[model samples]
Target: MLTLKYFFEPNVTINYPFEKGPLSPRFRGEHALRRYPTGEERCIACKLCEAICPAQAITIEAEEREDGSRRTTRYDIDMTKCIYCGFCQEACPVDAIVEGPNFEFSTETHEELLYDKEKLLENGDRWESEIAENLRSESLYR
Candidate 1:
């Protein structure tokens, strides 16, 4: 019976690390900092995300600009504490923050994984193509 079952069934094991499986459109992987049309930071320091974060992993400091626009003076996401629930992304009105497709976020140090504004922006820039492709591949955003 076992031999018969094996003969009839297909291989269910995935060859991960070499042949990675596809992720769902709503998969919350990593966080990214988005940019504006003019290439400026997209976060408007609204504090909605901060308020909505159940993990309390997001830290945001704001300041008034010359144009009277409230901008984030300091923004940090403690990846160690983050549960990747996508609440921050959902709370963002301007879509400044997003949970990206890249999941290879291993780090040697705990502090290294705690992504700051610069690191988040770098991740956004590096994974922009992949993020765009993922978004385009799914109908969720449409």
Candidate 2:
């Protein structure tokens, strides 16, 4: 039988906790906010990403810093409303917002899916190296 033919073959099932399938170079998993090597945030608060989101999941408010430079005061993303269209990353002029290689952001409550500025910045710090590698591998604005 067709079902019996596979019985003699080796198991191909992956142990998910210990192994994971490779994501494509173009894969957009989760959002992150990047900072410069000097620890300064890269977003100019231009609101380009906010204007470009079809799902209206991204919200940002910018204010002038002490140096009279613009910076975001509040940046929030509702992950539940996101369409994963990758537009936010594309619309960023300074490459401040990016979709990192993280897909394991599941939470027990919906409230946890609402990401604030602090969470986004933390995500950037956590995944910066991986994000850079993904960008370089994809030849995307590296």
| Residues 1-142 of candidate 2: C-alpha lDDT, one tens digit per residue | 9889999998899899799988887789889999999999999999999999999999999999899889999999999999999999988999899999899999999999999999999999999999987878877553
Candidate 1 per-residue C-alpha lDDT over 1-142 given as tens digits, one digit per residue, 9 for 90 to 100? 8899898888788888888888877777889987865789889999999999999999999999999899998989998889988889878888788889878878899889888989888878877777666656664664
lDDT score, candidate 2, position 45: 99
Worst 10 residues of 1 by lDDT: 133-142
Model 1, residue 73: what's the lDDT? 83
Q: TM-scores for all candidates?
A: 0.87, 0.89
Residue 35 in model 2: shift from native, Å?
0.8
RMSD of each: 2.3, 2.0
lDDT of each: 0.84, 0.92
